[model samples]
Target chain A: MLNRYYRVQAGPEGYLPPAAASMGVMLPEKGEALVEGIIVSEEEAMQKIAEKIVNAKNPVFFPGPNILWAWNDSVLEKAYAVNDLVQSSGARVIPMPDYRPKYPMINPEVEINPNHPNLTIWHNHIDVCVFVGVHCHYANIALKIIRGGTDCYTIAICGEAGHEDAMISLRDVSIDTLRRLNDVIKSTGEGLK
Target chain B: MNKGLVKISPCFEDVMPQEYKELVEKGSYGQDYGVADLGSFKELIEEHPLCAGCGLALSMRLILASLPNPESTIIVGSTGCSALAFSQVALHNIHSLFGNQNAVATGLKRALKLRFPDEIKDVVVIAGDGATADIGLDMVMQSWFRRENITTIMLDNEAYANTGGQESGMTAEKAVLNMAPKGKNFPKVNLADVAQVAGCAYVATCNPAKSRVLEKAVKRAILAAREIGPTYVQIYAPCPTNYKLKPDEVLATVKNREKEGTYPTGEFISAKAQELFESLEGGSK
Candidate 1:
């Protein structure tokens, strides 16, 4: 509920707080931002993220159970797509090693750990952490603590907004939204740099 | 550290894999090792190096015999005496970490279900009391809470029999064991009661020495997991070496515990499971 930039409010869905509305995506057809909360479209969310992806110095991706929930049928394919885009952008990916070592890298990875302290160790180094479809309970409140203590920016793509941790929350997104985000980054990423 | 290893193998260099291969090639020595033909058509387990009158070993044999479909069942074992004989059993088995049997089984069951979808593959967790009720209790309880379609069998041998008879959480109150010089101070964990409250569709406590009760409990646990949610079967197994009793007195120890009202043997089926089972049974008939 407590965030640096975004304000929380109830929506028809869980909670829809606009992600990167300040990034200036002109949407005359979708209407202006509401008094309740700004409703950012998937295309706008992807475009904003694309700019960040090309300009990122040290970005990290922490994918969670939502990835499994969204891409229940083809989890491996979606994970590989996300991994390829993140890795190509020179981002570090970490997963809960102890519980499911093969989960983070639905394909394969070199390192894994359940404890989130490994993320805290690189406090000053990491500029942004992209949490795609992460649940609230999985990380032991480490996400909230990490955002509260450190200056690292976070972008959460999950079922709802008001995730306290993420600076820009693309709330109430489907599996296609995530895939398109990766695609946008893959295509327009070269132009930004 | 190497003293015990040396004693088990006096001339370890000569104990080669070729010797076991030749013994298998002979093929006529099936009945030579005193394999019991206890009215059963087939034997799922083979002779192992467990001590005489070992109640845990007997419990494992009874459990293996009670599986509804041995070919489709996968046993996930933890570190303990039972793990030593797991390799000897003629079935699919996995020995993960000491207290991670339930966690490993959860992932395996979910993954298997996703892959197969049509076939019913039974995934069972078979481990000692120390692995289940003590160290791995959180994982076991969490799996049950999540309603994982799996069966868990805890061979309750009172103490940590595998690790030099140390005191475990399942150790009975006022009983003086290895680590508890004065007394255990706490009562034994009634895991059957815990399982019943934790949403387990089937829960039972049985003495392995009573072969019929243990077998029935194991079968029900497996069958109930398919229809209902998770199931748990706790077998009261006694250790002779740790209890400082004669090899023939292990069953007597379990009997005394049951008689003293410490470890009662009976099955506890949930209401939903009972209804579903009876309907399925009636329809089949």
Candidate 2:
């Protein structure tokens, strides 16, 4: 018998629980380690993220569609937290251009092709790129390209599991997580000044 | 396509898009990528415009990740919500007419076979239920009957979600929508059974609620279509907008439906395809 998170009950016709249907198949495990390629506590990861943003000459926050969509009640709070972080850290917030037309228009100041992060980094001379509320798969694609072809450091503040490819990954991030990080960045930046 | 074609020119290295450069350096061209390898490597799909928590979008992401040969594969899409995301796919994809996906795949597969006879160029047709079960049922069935070496996958949202919520052939009986004001008159189309009868070498009915199951079905369908004949995989990708369900509620709804026996996941493989899978599994073991 397989252990399932959801309770299984017998139904009428051909319905079988996912565990039974997927017998002998190995499902991908959800990873909880906040940072990848290194072991660190959640507080340590947050400190590292704040330090990178505060120390960088030019840092930009790339907010993906999840920040705009009202998919859940926490999303609006997440967006507000991101705004607070940008304000405190003096980071430029760029909404990642999406195919959807109704949402935010492309920013004329920075032409950041979501497919090509290096171009944006090169054109704007961005030193650090912080990704928040971006879908996991898309973020993975961008992070790999940025790491492989650009000098800009990458940070991912994910709603779920941490990204293994990101330089500093804050996993299961909530509004509190963002607020705490923002406080750290403000203090760090003030100390530097 | 030659892998070197995407390589950045020495002179244009400073100007070429970083994505193309990364594709040459770390893309999943000849390598094997399963669901477990998702966030570790560069995915073929970029940011999509789909709704938040859209099951169709998640299904597309998982399907792309599960492709056995992403480099050599060409996707044939149709007019629907899925078409919007096709533009962002890193692999070569064609958005055909609303109901002409299989027709397009047939020609594309034949032409690619002629162009590269020795190479394996897998042509796949991915469309919505409205396009597959109703609009292009004839063309889709004919392709399977002819045993065209292509895979046909239906992103079954159960209604015409791209347009305002309209009743589609795949919509379940008694489901109220724009066209079906009172309720849908007929039960959902039995597309899986029809595919089996229409000479499909392998057939499956799955949903995104079971990502691993969906992944295995997609991988098997593509692999079977490579040598065996036509293949079909119907994925129940729920439409949160049209269904009036919250984004996060879609997966739970699918799970509830599965438990209630309204929608179940199963597979049907021909003897030849079964033999192929057994041999492949044995080798891997």
Candidate 3:
């Protein structure tokens, strides 16, 4: 029998609506629990990441398939805007391998999978890694690479709840949230100057 | 601020920044409409890597130029030799995974309509026969069944030309190909008739060598899709590399193959399409 399977539905990352919106969660009835957290709101986490970036010597940003999931021209512009906000703060932004990057921060040699060849090279030196809209599975692998190799701080900012190991799990992921976060960072950074 | 939640930028018009409105209207989201001069139209398609006299390339060029509203049209492609030429095509193009252009187009069309209800956006899928007829048959049928407003054009080169010319479901019987060393055993899948039966508002089978007929069929298909729902045009494009024929022989192969129950040309407008066309004509008059 020929099996024709296409990903008609979005992956875990695709299920996220904006943080302010209510959505029914789809859970597996008979599997090990996938999500566990301290229940911090998404906004507080963004502020903390902003503070961390302001203080940290080395910070890296990893963005995932959320851009592709949105798939609208306007959505793309928004994604780029968020990237710009992070970039202006002097953070090294890396795009998910599958997603086309607006900037050249993503190491094309490194893929999103666990066994990427460049993962070993980036495993140790970074002080903090801020994950924005990365899939739960990839986020876990990234944690493994960073935690196993360095005493690095990890933060997750996402629409859905999954990254159990993140020091701060900011759960609200919507474009509105990014806009507010951008405003705060822009003001604070400019205030310091 | 929802610090715990990581928010991305919103592209939805309601949430997107105001400055982007002008960008969307200025054809930044899609490609410019290349010149429409017949016989010697300026090429929207730059030089491509396809073999010389590749019928699929010719058909794509014609279809790209015949989009009717290239500025507002988004072309979705799937994995095939046809997709290889997409990078060079000036129009806003997307290459989704193999065998899923229809599904992608369905989502894209619906999204565009939702975002711009006042504007007319054309979502067209141009894919190879294998993607449309074999692997993507289910999605293609589903889109037609849903009556999605989109146009799908299949550049049918008979076999799976990109993957070393393997025998596809659309491969003609007795045609020897990679996997069918002893000649293909089954007849071509009746995709045009399938589209007709599946309630596609307009269906046509044309060849690139007959540019006028192909262009008319494409134009009609696009126009019909605006009001009459899904439309399909399957062009009999030949693969010279796969067919083991000289580059110049591609046109003749499509033209002469009709005697063997292949490459039938003409339009098949459903009753709904006919009604829609009449109403449009009446309203204009």
Candidate 4:
């Protein structure tokens, strides 16, 4: 059996809405939570990060869809070995699925979840119909088969250290990769875990 | 077609006929004839669209209907269904790139002011809360700071409906919404407050599901941006896909949100930026 498992840099910040919204409770702002740091406005900043990704000698990985959960230690080990194997086979190692968690105090307004899930599902509220599962039965299934939004996932390099994986939030992605991943997940019904 | 009928903009009318006036006022017709005649228009639209269905169609129509000129409105959008849909529309209309919708609209508005000072038009920045609150926050601020005459509408469908229903700033924290970091734990940085402080002259919120409220808010934003300067408006557009409910529930959700003041859905006249819009009549504003 494949015994599918996942890695966790941080867990998907699950069931966090009301506690975050309530007064006196200090939760991360929506903006601060999505990315590791304040949004980079200057091109130089993005360039600097991009350069880091390109220059990293170590293998790169994709973060989970969210911040709270990433993967279990065992699953992550498999992934790291896979990366090493792929690299040894003479395939160019791509720095992807890197995540940068925001730390509090230093960048206090939005703090990082020190303990998040293995597959931190990095979803977006603006586009992918978050209310999907509860409101409509066929939406995800129908949308998944078509390779629509949230149907697939990918990898990026933002804050992964060594074999540790993380998802870097890129503004856009390649459709080919998206379609391929969707096909795999659609077949399994596991949702890119 | 009824023999006594005189066509007036599909479902809406110019003047009320005594016999049919009540039917019209009572919201008789839901579908329209306008959609049929445009050959391959539906097919073409269906090509790249993300199944937003009629809601998005009417949304663009309503926004484009009063465009001083669609060509003049240089749209700036971040990555969302709205952006993709706008890209599809741009095939026929004049549009700029994806993302940076607010930034582009700001520059376009400034260019219009500098080049065609007297041309009363708009440069709309179409977007979603995920873009506005999460990614495009700074862009919106800078546009207002520059005092450019443009309008940016941040359509809040609660969650990040495009990249998979994740949490957004506009999504009330822990409202049983999506996979958020901690839900909006911190008080939402009141966007209107931020705009006012940033020197915006007008800010408003509306749900187009309520056509009158939407039209009124949009009209105000357009006027403010054209006459005075840049403005911001947030629309509570619901996402059944994310919410996992029927599309029509959007109206009820929006209404409840409005009543609770969780989502501020009204035209706000900011004192700074540029005084374009008249202070809404009375204190009712």
Best by DockQ: 3
Tens digits of per-residue lDDT for model 4, B147-167: 877888777776777776787
Q: Report the CA-based lDDT of candidate 1 relative to the real structure.
A: 0.65
Stretches off by above 4 angstroms in model 3 are A1-52, A55-88, A92-156, A159-169, A173-193, B1-58, B61-65, B68-125, B134-148, B162-164, B185-190, B193-199, B209-213, B245-264, B270-285
Model with the higher lDDT, candidate 2 or 3 = 2
Worst 10 residues of 2 chain B by lDDT: B7-16
Which tens-of-lDDT digit does each residue in B1-285 have in candidate 2? 545344432322333345545766777767788877878888887678888888899999999989988878999999999998888787778889989999999999999989999988989999999889999998999999999999999999999987888999999999988766899988899999999999999999998889889989999999999989999999988999888899989999889988899988899999999998988877331
Specify the CAPRI tier of model 1: incorrect
Candidate 4: chain B TM-score against the reference chain B: 0.71
Per-residue lDDT tens digits of candidate 1, residues B1-285? 111111111111122233223323332122221123344344555576667788898888878777776657889999999888886665668898989999999999999999988877899999999999988999999999999999999998888886777878888887776666787887888888999999899998999768877776787788889867899999988878677778888888889889998888887888887786677557331
True-structure RMSD for candidate 4: 21.1
| DockQ of the candidate models in sequence | 0.01, 0.01, 0.09, 0.01
Q: Order the candidate numbers by lDDT, best to worst.
A: 2, 3, 1, 4
Candidate 3: chain B TM-score equals 0.84
Query: Mind sharing the TM-score for model 3?
Result: 0.57
Which window of ten consecutive residues has the lowest lDDT sum in model 2 chain A? A8-17
Error of 3 at A36 (Å): 13
lDDT by residue for model 4 over A1-193, one digit each (tens)? 1111322112233333111112122212222211222233223323333333333333222212221112344334433443332333222221111122211111211211122211122221111111100111122222222122222221222221111111222222223323332333233332212
Q: Candidate 4 falls in which docking quality class?
A: incorrect
Flag regions of model 4 displaced more than 4 Å: A1-193, B1-48, B52-58, B66-68, B90-99, B114-118, B181-184, B270-285
Measured against the true structure, the TM-scores of the candidates, in listed sequence, are 0.52, 0.61, 0.57, 0.46
